[model samples]
Target: MKFCLALLSLFFAVVVADHGDHSDYVVKTGEDLARYRDQCVAKLSIPADLVEKYKKWEYPDDEKSRCYLKCVLESFGLFDDAKGFDVHKVHHQLGGGDVDHSNELHGKIENCAKEGDAAGEDACTRAYRGALCFFKENLALVKQNVASK
Candidate 1:
């Protein structure tokens, strides 16, 4: 009985740890974006004015801003330096796990992924390209998705 209990505890621990590592977060609000932005700004020591301008949608196209977006994407678990953005993850988060919306976003994500791939070798640059494409192509949807409730 003790051995069986120990095995159960081990299984539970593994499940919990795995869940913690791959947190299932849905970035569906301005608050969600703000949290990631604040964390990234602090981590990268990004200038306050730059963040303000970005909040206003005046994307800086600078190194710090580029990497800042990359950091934000990473926080959302939608991107990584080596793998770029994860389309399925982005679609699920932005589409609210709706299958219909997922189908619609897949094509756009793929197109943006292609653009990102063409954006040279800088991981930051690639992230920025993909992010920019997504926003530009789906401005209304993107805005609605990130609008604070």
Candidate 2:
């Protein structure tokens, strides 16, 4: 009976750990992180005043990038707790490296959900909008490889 209890506890721990990892994320290459992020950007424009501020963050860093992004995703009511963060803020903030912004958007949304506020919402939305404009103005056309279903 003790052995069975131990196994059960281990199983629960593993499950919780898995969920925790999924709660935060990173976007690799050739993934939808870029695509969805673009779609969001296409919809919203990052605030002009915040553009330089965003330009200061490190590219692809998970936490700060996620905070700015959460504002956009959750505002649209598309915040995903798992497997759904797509952040464009990282792109503009990080000097527009060859990174994927779409995947990061979901995380931004998650952060916003955690800390609910009109200020956060406004900031995120402006970030998203500004990031989008920055990207569209600066980069080549996004290859619509697989159209969204």
Instruction: Say which candidate scores most in lDDT.
Output: 1
Compose the digit string of candidate 2's lDDT tens values, residues 1-149.
99999999999999887555433333223244445444534454544444344444222423344444654444433343342333332332232234443555434533533333334344444444444443444333222211221
lDDT of 1 by residue, 1-149 (tens): 99999999999999887544335655556887888888998999998899888787667789998899889888878888887777767776667654353365788887897788764579899988988998888867777777833
RMSD of candidates 1 onward, in order = 6.3, 11.6
Cα-based lDDT for every prediction: 0.79, 0.41
Q: In angstroms, give how far residue 112 of model 2 lies from its true place.
A: 15
Candidate 1 stretches with Cα past 4 Å from truth are 1-28
TM-score, candidate number 2: 0.26
TM-score, every prediction: 0.75, 0.26
lDDT score, residue 88, model 2?
A: 35
